[model samples]
Target: MGKLKGEYIILQNEQFYLKGYKDFANERLKIEDYRGNIEHIFSTIRKLQKEDYVHKTIVKCRTKSVPSFLGQGYMLEGCIPGYFLGGDAYFLCKYHDQKRFTSSMWVEEDKQLEEVWKKDGDIENKGVITPSIRKATTLDAKKLATFYASVFPIYPVPIDNPDYVKDQMEENTIFYCIETDGQIIAAASAEINMAYRNAEITDCATLSSHRKGGYMYDIIQSLENELVSKGIFCSYSIARALSFGMNAVLHKSGYSYQGRLKNNCYIYDKIEDMNVWSKDLSALSAGKSALSAGN
Candidate 1:
């Protein structure tokens, strides 16, 4: 009924059941970082779905729980390969509102994804010269927030808040950016879940003035290097279903399309569908990045 709500979790007998929150603006319940019995989680999902009038419900669980979740009428929305300590993580979704679960843009989105994959997947295929890419610190949060504001009029999270951005930096989010003459031009972040040995390569953006220069690819590649150094083996991204540029970058980075989440979040101006892309980042035991095929 509002912008956002408090995060809640279910703990029983000193065990974790469900850990996530209700998103009021997005009209959904998000369950992530949960460890408990499947029955408890399903009960909570039912209770909350009707209580909140949520359009959709999503649960991100590990490989072992996939069959159980799917048995509860939850469908596979996507998979984060090797996300849980070398085991895979799965995103299972249930829709309270059938209309919200179906995407009108599915046909068009499929066309764009295939088009990008055919054109190129080379990291070195640059159209313009890119500036140096570097890791961002807390000092850059304000400008980074400003940069995000310029790109997205509204985002699912409080990414436009400088304080929130700073808080994320102090936490597990590592940001990367490209500066042009001391001004932040392009940026991205690696949201690390050290417990699971996974990272989410997201928050990617480039200035309108710098779009075709391969800035995004270079910036994300730099973030990947940092994530690899931190021992992350799985990396994934959820891009807008309708955004040709976003989907193209994911394809070019060697990430394979897993599935799509429908009516997932509010981005730019309204509710939008999201396409999931994932990559299993293997350790450099073979002397090359697991994602090196795209390069």
Candidate 2:
């Protein structure tokens, strides 16, 4: 266990913390990864947000900085995540190759959801909607978590436990839903790394009943529109190579393929390739409805 340093003022404890690093290889940082301490982090951030600290930018690193366990994490509030604060959130890994660093190298790219624009105002209904689109309340966490576990093979720290989903929902990291007929279904949410001014769209799913009904598309489009109106035009998301449908959605919405992290993701039956895609609202071709579709 090491330490972290920065000009962080913990509002709840009435204390100030200096930036440093913490080592977890020999021990578990918290109940989970260091992120479990988010309650403490949010205490100060919540106050900062109230005071408009969104403009402040701070660089931080894992213990040992370079050649460390979790690598380094930086925080710059105003700029877009991932690109601007490219090294903000990452995990370090030791490559067996002789040329690799002795300890390890940090590898993480901040990805965020950038809201694009409203399509001629919201339509009361999207085509063949099965699960109704609604804002997820705290109560829906259990179903939401289960939906994500079913759709994609990502096992959270708690896997399919509803309590874990509830925890995530409480942290604004989850949204939930079900079919219009009341059958449990779709879930979506933003996994925000506030330290990097970036957020990733995670746990997005639509159950079989809601499939092909355009519910997921509509919900994502709405979120994008909201972000675009707020001036957040760039975001990054990773999709499994086999998830052609997900990739197709990003393409239709105007996301470009920046690059890929070879064989770096775990999907249901195998280790999957992570496809990195970026959406640039600054240059949406006029009258272009489906950029990825035509290409």
Candidate 3:
């Protein structure tokens, strides 16, 4: 087995990620012969259990391997369409502790919140000055970390570390922040997949004092516009299932509800399900192609 900074445990063929900060384990099976390696995969899961790193196990595999994972007591959580170059990806999970599996309260909360937002009408920015929305530079890493730490106890990425946040920003990840009086009050990111022409909008956070002002919605809209201008065709987010405000943001922003991934991530000291929301931006391009063909 190989190890990467003790964060990921890489086997000969598969890899198990020990999300130490989150206290959960996730696996990625890279081999094509998933059917043949069922026993090996289970054994690796058992190893994860013995190491006391098993609050839950999330398995991300291609659509074709769903059956193999299902045979091993893994339940189908959800599917992310066009996640893999026009092919869909499926998420399966096996919860070691039954207590970790609970009904998703966000589903109902989302419906109620949607109705409320509809009745209340658009969020007013009157009298309240809007923050400047712009791309974050590496110099803003420390501020970003501070904002994230204040919002979430545990996150998938090392948001507590300014260096890690800076590195990701230097890489393909683009961070957008809402700045007021030289302070970042809210932030979000787009993980661009240039090969697939899609992007994952994630890491949305806002200071407690700055909540309910539609800053996140503005950030999402700005990010989506930037992505579309860059030739990206799809944008999606895996928002916390229990967050009424976040779900409402996606719903009001024209993103369609796709599905839910159960026990997908650890946040606020517990394993939480995630709701998938996506928007397709390829309609204009498809229409142009059809017109060109007719001409």
Model 2 stretches astray by more than 4 angstroms? 1-82, 85-94, 97-131, 153-159, 172-178, 226-232, 281-295
**Cα lDDT tens digits for candidate 2, 169-223:** 6663535354555555665665544444445665556666456555656666655
Model 3's C-alpha root-mean-square deviation from the true structure amounts to 5.6
lDDT of each: 0.80, 0.44, 0.70
lDDT of 1 by residue, 9-79 (tens): 65454544566777776778888767766677677667778865588888887888888988888888888
CA lDDT, candidate 1, residue 264: 90
**Higher-scoring candidate on TM-score, 1 or 2:** 1
Candidate 1 deviation (Cα RMSD): 3.5
Best by TM-score: 1
Give the Å shift of residue 5 in candidate 3: 8.9
Order the candidates by TM-score, highest first — what do you get? 1, 3, 2
- Cα lDDT, model 3, residue 180: 79
Off by over 4 Å in 3: 1-6, 9-51, 103-129, 194-197, 284-295
Residue-level error in angstroms, candidate 3, position 210? 2.5
Highest lDDT against the true fold, candidate: 1
Error of 2 at 161 (Å): 2.1
In model 1, which regions exceed 4 Å deviation? 1-10, 14-16, 121-127, 283-285, 288-295
